[model samples]
Target chain A: MTSAILVSILMTLVAASTPILLAALGELVVEKAGVLNLGVEGVMLTGAVAGFAVAYSTGSTGAGLVAALVAGVATAMVFAVLTLSLTANQVATGLALTIFGIGASSLIGAGFVGRTITRLGPAFPEALSGHPLLRAVLGHDIVVYLSLALVLAVSFFLNRTRPGLILRAVGENDASAHAIGYRVIAIRYAAITFGGALAGLAGAYFSLALTPMWADSLTAGRGWIALALVVFAAWRPARLLLGAYLFGAVMTAELQFKAAGVTVLPPEALAMAPYLATIAVLTMMSLGPKSGRANAPACLGKPFSAS
Target chain B: MTSIITRRRFNFGAGASAAALPFTAGRALAQAPLGVGFIYVGPVGDHGWTWTHDQGRLAVEKEFGAKVKTSFIEKVAEGPDAARAIRQLAQANNQIIFTTSFGFMNPTIQVAKQFPKLFFEHATGYQRADNVATYNARFYEGRAVIGTIAGHMSKSGQAGYIASFPIPEVVMGINAFHLAAKKVNPNFRTKVIWASTWYDPAKEADAAKALIDQGCDIITQHTDSAAALQAAEQRGVFAFGQASDMKAFAPKAHLSAIIDDWSGYYVKRVREAMDGTWKTGDVWGGIKDGMVKIAPYNDAVTPAARAAADAVQKGIVDGTLHPFTGELKDQKGVVRLKAGEKASDELMSKMDWYVDGVQA
Candidate 1:
């Protein structure tokens, strides 16, 4: 209950939430564009490994972040080519991509395993961020700020901009959007590419900012959690931010409470709290007046083969 | 001794399993190297539990040279899936397969029944069949040593334990560590955080950070990763590496490590199989037998801490001190072991309760 412990808990929560928020926000855009890409897990793994390997080699965390973006987009492009270009089953291809990511990352990460690197440091200097109370908000690295900013940018792009409206139009009714000369396929492609870049960044956050090391499946299936988050937020970027931080708080609280030596519940039950909360909230979302499914883009997951 | 194989069926079913062994010896005599297969729950590069087992695999290859062919399937999740992986090794003509994970117990037993002739060694499992054996290191002995170090070096009087599960093996380690630390500092407390998974770096790091932030100055983990050590390093807290020496991962924070040395056991077991001496039984090797070894003390480990840790290791090896000794009590003040008595293997094997001063 000390202020120091509380601050530490806050710090851990933000760090834990930022990566998922980034990935969820990216997936939110993808889903909004009427493309249901389930390969976020695989794409994130490729980004994590590529990020760690590049950062370890170049000794520049910046270069590592760039590599992660490129790797993520590249792997996402594979899904795009198969699903978007060839009109394959998105669900099956997404699962296959995850399996491929697991194997490929392990093979590439073999060398980087057992290796360590300089972790991303706070963006602000100690003068401002070192304050115990202020540290909660200011001590975070660049990704934390970037995630919040992206949420705003994504919200604006989807609602305020003309291109955003066209993109949403394509998702809502692709054939109609195509009839209106919106180039539905091209807009969807761009949205999918943007989503991949963000997911890749999120994966890099895990490798470079979070653990600063490489291991097989290092993202630990957080990509799937990000995918769930898109649904949890009903594809709203701002709500996605809320959901990610909420999930992070629950996850961190589970560990922090145990670390504080408070026996509120058995360890198993404590470990299951975040997951139970997720299921409960999702159920509520489904039963609410505005059913979450109603918010889904009509053409979502449907392969378009305009004959 | 081949007496470890505890089956007396004179029936054809038993005879068929026994018949498979002679075929293995015959194939070896026919100039075919003994095919040894290993299945790991984590990647070999984990630098922890599976990494140590993989090292043993390399040792087997080194000891036998061309007389043995070793192959491994890494990152095999333990479940029905593990059975498939184990069977794939069996189908590939591997004479002896090592399934190295606790969760692989059922799958290992099931696969051994099908490959009645093929020998299977499952690590840290309780089950054994005619073709299935279990072998494990006395990792508690290593824990006792590190716990002693934590007792002497910990300024916070609180140490963090990053645990993987509630199994006897993990619980035994927690009790051993808490007991040893309490022997040095009677008021010492251990905080245990069950991570559920053995090898998730992100979660492990978070657990370590939570503990360190909560004022647990010393961190020790039973999980199979160096992530906790790295977390402790970031926070400038003392830590003990698990399974392997991870000093390089956290040079400043690493006080010592409980190293799992399986190379000697693997070499001996492989040799036994080649000489037609393989049998199904349980083998629990400790410091005395070199199955568990303590790493060299870091410079940061004070002289007093080093002396105390070394004394604990020596006592365990010489049988002068037992971790689960006289007048032990569970957290609820119930005496589990009375004065002048020691815990038996059966008690340790099924240990599920936490000891006094252990907040798990």
Candidate 2:
């Protein structure tokens, strides 16, 4: 029974973590090339509304997913031009991008209120869907599988590939990279855009797969969770999966506790568990020996300069 | 064929399409008209408060025809974003603006002061100016009935209330529910849970479950979301819906719902504004006025329950029933109203204390 619960919990975690994982992986890549796009939330929201609207109109979930990616990329391009091209403050520009994305998406989603989209049917591998322990541990819609695969793929690219190494070197020391004849600005822009695409994909997953409907402000700070997960994973790709899943499990447990008849805690307290856990994790990580320089990229928030 | 020929001939003579055209079309076509703007804090769905207001807007367009043009921005954030959004709408030539949301009260008042000629209507606020009119539904009237029903139906002598804020509007509902529940079951007590949000499904669901786990069998909410109904269904508890009919989310669990109908008020007010008859006043309408409605009772309600609810409904409509009749007690059992005394508007408006049966 315990194993069954454990397996089911794990499966649920994977499903819940996909959007965050997909988003974090993209940010992982972006960070490796030294662009900090704090506008992931806005980009994801844009993707969510756009994807839902298109899918709603076209009656095709695939089309909706594509539209989400495109929306994310388009919004990201705006951020790229402002920060990467115009040499604006990365943090400020990223914040501005998030604000713009929120306003635009909210405007678009207003008319979509209370409208139902056709649910995307199950996407788990057939064999695992029916299996008892295996099903609970492995089964989920496509987003979960995509998130896992992307994590592994990102880890491989960052550790083994020539271009991935160059990206990392640029993030670590852009001046040194510039001196060595690599185009830092171009690399960071590409990385930021790719990050935006992934964030968009994450947003699409929310509307197209998870809840499968459009809602105003529906992302509910999930983007911030993705960003925090990046830090919690110590900027490593493999740990991102574990950290996101763990947070998902904690969130799921809060709901399940009330469902399974735990009456000890008040509902407000239960609702606060996940946020409180995030705070605790942040505090623990900050207090750990690896403090400042161990996990974060040295030039994580620094903008690339030609000089 | 003969009928079709006659219908065609009738159409030619009657000019149905031409008649359907707005008489104001000529005037509108002569010059570009001023744009009107609406800003909402919620999405305009088919049910609930926002949906009702949107329906009202559609009514205005239908009534005024082409002479008046109105547009809306939905799900606008409260503080700075609201200011910017209002400015944007004003810049876009919106001469009149309606800002909906409690948080928009001060901002709307401030913005209206900035644009004196521009008319502004705000919902659920007291602040007003020559151009700013305030409006709200008398939600407490509906709560009084729900309270009575809960008082009669509660099996566990415990009820749960999902509240959105600590404001007087929400607090009044909580107190009213508790008072009514106490009338039916003197031992009955209520657990008040604040989710601190108007609409968060996950949080609302958990709150419902928590209340149920604490032994509350009847649930009422002053928040948005069908999650409470969903939670009640899972727990096989009796619940009441808020804002919108959430029967789809909790068909078996929901006893009834409080639905807001803004179309009537909206159409009247907007037309009045367009006709230059719109004066700054506080409009608060309830059951008797048809602004608030209780949906059909579910199958789970017993014959006695149905009869009781029907009787209450009749009383409300015929002025024979009073939800806030005299002889009410505060949480400390202090008598706030004497027997046969009607609850004053002043008392209801400033009600900040919970009744005796509610557990804070």
Candidate 3:
């Protein structure tokens, strides 16, 4: 391929990967704090609609992003309350949140259908953003950079900081942390809220940056794929970034081959490639050393009452 | 005066006898405001397939005024859920129910059997019973017009088609676009990509960008979203919208669109049922019947190209042009239709093979 074509492909790949990476990173933190919230998909949908509606009505992309973050956090709290307080089944409650998100987003977004918004544009100046050679690196919107920065920050926070250590301690052994006076429940709530915020931002990425238009169920189950990425990453923020990009590349390969007039495989097979790759990667991750399986928190998915 | 009196008496006698018949009892009950119900497979706000259908429902309400009462449930999933939804409409006393999705075919038939007194209409489906009727638009006719425009406007002679499925309806559109493009430039080629979905904006946008990167100057989609058109606009390529006019989404890149106009048919069918003339049959209406229309050309289209497109549309409407005429060959170089022979409705409905110059 030509250099220009390669750059175009890279650009599309980055765009495709950013949302999942953002969502997966948040889930990684939540799981690290010993909570499993499967409501990522639903929260994302709510964020998508909230972002689109706010952006369309106010004609401001920043306001729209804020709205999406709020919507995401709010939706996440529903799961947090039910699972963290009421002691509901994490799996069942997460699934219910997704269904509710689909219905509620559709209802909320009903008026915004067919509406268009000015897409979130590049953050840098046109001199660098428009240069053919430098454009690939500089042309991306703010969210793409934010996602990468978050990966690094999360990696540092989980492995280096004192609070990060405490959060990990709570996840590893909630009872011991509770006895140590770490406020296990409060930390878990905070972690869940953070996850919800990131998921909301990821969801808004679809509406405000990726497609720049509104439609019902626009996320199209990408949220579920983000959930899978958390496991594929073994709950590591850095690995989550790599997994998200890998998935993005696999997703773009089908379109690339068809566009290049390479008909080696049928269209159906090409469409199935990314999904098959997801399953394969997950299986390979599980097949590694038994210690890899131990990466999951001991207290993960277990509710702590501290009574 | 005596002759007029006799005629009036004869008309009254015929009407009384028709109402007295057991089979016509349901028609007699139509004197009350006719209730029309629509079942959509997607949200009405989709701005594509379902949106057009909902527009038709609105037309029925506008045309009949208080004589007709219309209701619809959007995003109704096909299969078992469809049957229940249809049954609920029937129970609510909707005299005519329009199930607007191919997947709803069997369910529509099943529900019709349970509610024999109701009139049923299914879109893009083949099944029919005494109470069931099937209707479709000749969308290929509109495709041919746009294809001719794409051929004339494209600089690279390569067009990209983002298809939803390999169903006969979508396959036929691909073949029709290629055949028309080839007529303009025999060396013209079309690249086809299957998204495997009817409406995913992100996937559709990616497909458009990929095609544009590989030298496709014009893009068209059978999927229901404006993403492809928006991509074309951003990439400075030409595109045609699907199902509805998406000119607003991509004002500069949108050359023209094949708009599905179901208002005429919906209004007519409702009128037929209201007048007790409804029947079980098939209706395939095209440009002539006002079922398929071409949107206005963009400012980018040359006057010559615009005239050519208009000519093609006129030819199809006047029965002088046939998209699947003789001299057609499949991708394997086997003749599908010999010269001077026109394709029958049955053959067109199940067309699965691509014509020459189509790359899938």
Candidate 4:
């Protein structure tokens, strides 16, 4: 009975964490190339509504996921043009992107309100789902497996490739990359677009798999949580998966405590557990030791300019 | 023949020709399309409160036919967005505007004062003026019937209530339901969960499940969703539905539902307004008037439960019963109503505190 319950809970944790995992993976790539985009939430939400609206009308969940990615990438292109091409402040541009995305998505999603859509199929093959341990790890919507694979692929790309080293060089010191004849602006723009498409896919996972319904403010700060996960992972692709899943487990436990008939604390306190833990972990990581910030990219939020 | 006489009598100095008839023709053309508009705080789907109101709009169109032209804007925000929606409707030539929400009261009043020619009707609010009339269903009257069913059906003496906000309307409902529940079972206690938002299914479900985990076998809500019913069904507990009939959402678990029938009132008011006989007034309708109705009880309810609910329904409809009649205690255990006394409109309107037996 305990094992069955654990399996069910782990399955829920995967579903809950997919959007965050997909989004943070993209931001991980962006950060590795040395750009800070706070507009991740805004991009995710726009994708969520846009993807659902299209899927709802077209009766195609795959189409919906693709549309979400395109919407995310498109919004990122807007940011790239303004910040990368115009040399505008990245922080201000990202904030404006979020504000714009919120208003634009609301307007576009107005027609699809209160409509329901077909639920997406599971991510893994039925053969894999039949296995005990593999079932718990792999039985999710298609986006979940893709996001997990993305982390592994990103880890390999960032650590094992010459292009990855060049991107890192651009981030750590764009002046040094420029001396070596690397195109700094082009790399950052590509990173930003990649970040947005991932954020969009995260949003699609929400509408396409999680609730399968459209609602205002549906993402509910999942983007912000993903943003925080980047720091919690210390800029490592593999660590991001652990951080995202851990936060997902914390959230799932709070809900399951009531479901499983365990009433150790008031429901309100339990409801706040995940957010409180995030804050606690962040404080510990920031204040505990000098070694904590060692893994963060040195030029994570700094913008580069060529004279 | 009347036009000829009126044209000569009113325009005595005018020549007797077709050019003199242009004024009357222009008047007829000006009154060609009568615009009607609705402002919503949430999206209008095929379910819930906003959907129900949108149904009323469709009813108005069907009732009036081509006499009225209707348009709507959904998901209008509570404060400034409400004001903008109202102005847009009025400026677009909507002579009759229905602003549907409690938070929309002040904004509706503000817009009504500015556009005196337009008739504004605010739902679930008390403030009223010449052009700004307020109307709401006597939802507590429906609660009295459902509470009686819950009182008989609940194996545990604990009942759960999912309430939205601490305003008078919701507070009155909580008090009324607890009073009715206590009348049947003296040991009955209500666990109240305030969600603080009008339509959040996830929050409402979580709250309902929390209450059930705390030993509540029966539940009811003053919010606007079938989520509580869905939650109750998942937990194998029974609950009453709110705003609209939610039998489809949780057929087995839903004992019954309190349905808001705004069509009758909407038709009457719009007809009167178009005929120039409309007068601003509060229309707080109850079960007797068919504005509030109880849906069919589920089979899970015992024979005794059915009889009790039916008796209350008959009493309300036949004027033999009043939900707020006789001795009643406030949240402080102070008796607010004595035996043989009927609850006053003033007290019911300003009911800010919960009654005894309600755990907030």
Interface RMSD for each predicted structure: 7.1, 12.4, 12.1, 12.6
Q: Indicate the DockQ of the complex predicted as candidate 4.
A: 0.16
- CAPRI-wise, candidate 4 is incorrect
User: Of the native A-B interface contacts, what share survives in model 3?
Assistant: 0.61
Candidate 1 Cα outliers beyond 4 Å, as residue runs: A270-278, B1-30
Model 3 Cα lDDT, one tens digit per residue, B189-240: 9999888888779999999999999899999999999999989998899999
Winning candidate number (DockQ): 1
- Summarize candidate 1's per-residue lDDT along A85-155 as a digit string, tens digits: 89999899988878777778877898998888999999899689666798888888988998899899989
Best by the lDDT measure: 3
Judge the docking of candidate 3 as incorrect, acceptable, medium or high. Answer: acceptable
TM-score for chain A in each prediction? 0.95, 0.90, 0.95, 0.91
What is candidate 3's TM-score against the reference?
A: 0.94
Q: List, in order, the clash count of every candidate structure.
A: 0, 0, 0, 1
* lDDT digits (tens) for residues A1-307 of candidate 3: 6888888898999999999999989999999999988889889999999999999999999999999999999999999999988999998998888888887888899899887888898878868866566879898899999999999999999999999999999999999999989999899999999999999999999999989988888888888889888887778887888899988987788788888878667767865665676677667767867634548888889888887
TM-score-wise, the better of 1 and 3 is 3
Clashing pairs in 3: none
The 10 consecutive residues of candidate 1 chain A with the worst lDDT sum are A270-279
The full ranking of all candidates by lDDT, starting with the best, is: 3, 1, 4, 2
Candidate 3 at residue B106, lDDT?
Answer: 93
What is the lDDT for A153 in model 3? 97
